[model samples]
Target: MRFPFFKQERRVEERPRDFRVISPRIIDILTHLKVQAEKLKRTYHRLLARDKELFEACVRAEQELDRDRATIYANEIAQLRKMSRTILKSQISLEKVIL
Candidate 1:
């Protein structure tokens, strides 16, 4: 004797796979990507503003003949520039994904 639980049954119907079913997920992913891109843009702009401020301070220090202070400010500006480059690259990549 065979058990009923041991028998395999085939599905009588299968739902059609179409764009309507997948559009929502695609939209959600694009929205997330856009948000991330905006964040990166904001961060990049903020870095630029800060870098400008540091550059001014460094110039002031140099005019005052303060080598150490100017050096420190210059180093910070360099680091900010590096961060900005990284953020810009990420933003570009996100834009490509969204497209």
Candidate 2:
């Protein structure tokens, strides 16, 4: 449909697409991730040590028939395992960031 009162205009030029460089922000994010990864690693190691002690204590509790104590240690071990998995995931993400 054409309107008698409207004018038809033609574009004479095309605008180029704008490109942006974001290396600095990326570097800052990677640096922060590196620090977080290190902290996660430290936490992982500490958890492992604590888990080992918990296992040993659980074993002693079992031998003594201390059901409640054994159950408590078992729960802690499960929590430690869950935390370890998160640390591993963070490490993998850190590797991806480096690449």
Candidate 3:
């Protein structure tokens, strides 16, 4: 899920040219991606903790077994990709400055 996002960010970061000199928008995008990636990382950590808590309760015979369809997570993953697609597809063309 987060793997593809991470991979795309890596590929973009690995570009042969340094756009820092020519495009601030690219830098901004990179920064935004880094922040979002961190957020996803934290979300994973929190979800893991939730799973662990559920497992502990289940082991103690206090938690009932309730399962959700896999599609729930799948849809969330798809939505994330859709958001990234929209973000990346946006263009910021430079305007000519009059002398």
What ranges in model 2 sit over 4 Å off? Answer: 1-25
lDDT scores for all predictions? 0.92, 0.87, 0.49
After superposition on all C-alphas, the RMSD of every candidate to the true structure, in Å, is 6.3, 6.2, 19.4
Q: Candidate 1 — number of clashing residue pairs? A: 0
TM-score for all models, in order of appearance: 0.77, 0.68, 0.43
67-87: candidate 1 lDDT, tens digit per residue: 999999999999999999999
Give the lowest summed-lDDT range of ten residues in model 1.
14-23
Cα error of candidate 3 at position 3, Å: 53
Runs of candidate 3 exceeding 4 Å displacement: 1-22, 62-99
Whose lDDT is higher: candidate 1's or candidate 2's? 1
CA error at residue 62 for candidate 1, angstroms: 0.3
Clashing residue pairs found in predicted model 2: none
- Winner on lDDT between 1 and 3 is 1
Tens digits of lDDT, candidate 3, 1-99: 567556454444555765447587766776776666556556655655555554554444433333343344445545655554444333211111100
Candidate 2, residues 1-99, lDDT tens digits: the string is 989799887777976755465578887987888888788888889988998999999999999999999999999999999998888898888878776
For model 3, state the Cα shift of residue 63 in Å: 10
Question: Between 1 and 3, whose TM-score is larger?
Answer: 1
